[model samples]
Target: MSLKVDKASMAFTFKGGMLPMTVMELTSADPERIRDQLAGKLNQSPAFFQHTPVVLSVEKLDEPHLSLERICAVCRAHKLLPVAVRGGAEPVKQSAWALGLGWFPPADGARSRTLEEVPTSDMPEESPAAAAPQAEAGAGRIYRGTVRSGQQVSAPEGDLVIIGAVNAGAEVLAAGSVHVYGALRGRALAGIHGDTRAGIFCRELRAELLSVAGNYKRLEDIDPQLLGTSVQVILSDAQLGITALD
Candidate 1:
């Protein structure tokens, strides 16, 4: 006559959200140097840099040395989308605003802490199946480029291939598969049209959120074992699985 009891812990459900933006500091003293850097990078990978969004950081610029207007014009001429300005002096900030660019303070305690300070455990994670279907069959565009933060690429016809890093705060949407040759530290959506067969492949798995069709998966729900040097994401039987690519 013995009594036994069993206890089971409940598994928590989480949703993945937007990845934070990666900062690219431009501290060159000479404007030509900055232009040359951009040109070299673009020349090396035209597809990767074309139409990518970027934030300008001018905190290091000396007074009357370089103007924000000039910087914005240079960025535009190089096909780089200037979306915001950060860590710049007052004049630079004002210039950015006048150029129709968004402005934000540098990542400080009063403003916002850097990504390192923010705990990863607190990030959002959700299943790809839970999202609302935003794509239709054979609807969307295919983009071959490096997706930086403040930039978004969407296709209604096919998949998207990013030859470079999908930095945080950037987004990639496709009606089919998504391939990232570089680190995927941003949000990527595949099978946007409810095609559960679409998948995502990345060289580095550091994305904030991953979604397929209407489902999504968050970071917290991801098993530590699945996070590795390379990863592949797939949806089968309405379930999303992250597995080693190799």
Candidate 2:
């Protein structure tokens, strides 16, 4: 006799989600050097090392032995968990699997704009000399409604323009910039693809978190004077800076 199993009670469901992640790019593979540097950084900003999950980018290094375990230990000691590794050799990939960490290939900044050339012979005679504008990096994507709690919106290829409020617990990310026409109460992350030149502009700023490129600042780190005013967040000197927009 076989026991009956309920199909409705399928245990768990799978859904796709977008979460903010940090990347730790290793310039030097020395474990001691990494530990010392992390110590200095922690001293400067204690809140930054809060058991954050990060992906190790080893694209720049060509070391045969990366000391992956020692480096991971140092990061873990500093409250950083290595979730996976990106862009490394075959040995590094095997090492990652041995340590139960995921491995990924080298990823580009973002899906960049694509262009094609049409030969004059194949062109239509009625085709206009000046073509119409397109929705790309400059035009970007526009959202016409509010972003509620737990809702996430992203402009993966270009800018993001929101015409409504972003409630607390919500998140908005853009590859280029974020323009909020209404109140911004949730997290706003610009330059999700590592473009430091991107920025954030809001009509009323009271965001929970703001990040430009990989540099971020929480609510408590934000200036009190810029709480309810129109502001712009930018990356300056490798730090996130918020100032009233004139």
Candidate 3:
């Protein structure tokens, strides 16, 4: 008689939780240069990039035909795990997949914001840090330029604050909260680590996507009148709440 045995896979429950991830946006096709720069940056801030999970972003490059394998190799050499590739041409994406890489599109029309086109406002002077969302009171990444399409800024430790517009196809993610002093046209995700009190604040509520904690809402779900106006997004009872920030 044969005894039935239960497989270990059946006993495991795969629950999902959010974690901080780093994205290496490649503007050049030179693998050596990238490797060198990354090495230097890592040396300066060893703790920040130590064994960090990285995603390769090649959408902003003039030439997307970079050697995916070489990039991956360099990442592995420096203890950076390359898990996925986002925003590249079809051929480039295909090559990455062949090298055992996953493909992810820019979340909510995410695009890269270049320094050439910046937002200008005639409003009273306010520091970038002051414009940031105040939630868990911790150090947050202060971005000074526009968040363009396919560009993403993530503050894994605390919150994220942008002094300029977040154009369509861009994303700003934070572990605590997100604040934008200008138009928010892309995506903003707060409380990525599941803090229910996380929130999103923007000067102009033109976002295509917004999320607090695990609750999410698309542009269509928001009131049309709220567009292009100051707004705040929060999570209440596992639901997304939008309100004007007076």
Candidate 4:
């Protein structure tokens, strides 16, 4: 029994791909203020943010001299796990590395389109496309309550509208378009049947996932600034485009 050890060893492989992660942009150096704002945001949908992994962005900070540990601690207090820091100088990076926090390369703005640059005409038109087959004259669905976890609503006819929140773990699907008068924190799929011009609109753009036509975007891929803003999501050039509403 003392000499019966197996000699086979397992090999490890690494596969790389883009991951959508939440980015918490900091505009203030005060930890207390950060806590308060974060708390308010979490309150809107606690289950969604609870224990969520996030990356910190200091690009907007005027006095970015606060302790990195303090920032991470505040995030932890609000149930957000701070995994990395972005857009900081060498000193901040050094501190974050020392504290075992990962560093994320700053995103390039030149290659990306600004939210305002998106055209308003990109929104899914209520009327059917000239070349696409049309739905029944008035086929659509309207819901008036919070779509809780495990709940799903699908409108196979034309459109879907919810007057309440689409909570985390919930889902909404539509053949034409999806509109949510309240917060959208769950999954939304429009043009499920391949309507290339389909769209998704929501009062609060906090959805964990979104899709228009066949283009899909996860929470991390979305701009953090659009979290609480009224937004319209559309598919352009096979890419998901998000535009803030007036």
Q: In every candidate, how many clashes are there?
A: 28, 0, 16, 1
Query: Which candidate wins on lDDT?
Result: 2
Q: What tens digits encode model 2's per-residue C-alpha lDDT throughout 79-171?
A: 999999988889999999899999989766331111113233333343232121213345477765566554567787789988777777577
Per-residue accuracy of model 3 over 98-145 as CA lDDT, tens digit each: 988899875433124433232344222455533334233357777766
lDDT of 1 by residue, 53-129 (tens): 77776655566345667766777788887788777677767777788988878755422433223343432333221
lDDT by residue (tens digit), candidate 4, 104-178: 766665412222232335423432321122123368877655665445677877999777678776778888899
Candidates sorted by TM-score, best first: 3, 2, 4, 1
True-vs-predicted CA distance for residue 208, candidate 3, Å: 0.9
The candidate that achieves the highest TM-score relative to the unseen native structure: 3
Worst 10 residues of 1 by lDDT: 127-136
lDDT per model, in order? 0.66, 0.77, 0.74, 0.74
Per-residue lDDT, model 4, residue 161, is: 79
Q: After superposition, how far is residue 5 of candidate 2 from its true place, in Å?
A: 10
Model 4, position 83, has a per-residue lDDT of: 87
Cα-based TM-score, every candidate:
0.45, 0.48, 0.50, 0.48
Q: Model 1 reaches what TM-score against the true structure?
A: 0.45
TM-score of model 2 (CA atoms): 0.48
Candidate 3's error at 4, in angstroms? Answer: 76
- Please identify model 1 stretches exceeding 4 Å from their true place: 1-145
What RMSD does each model have against the real structure? 16.7, 11.6, 13.9, 15.4
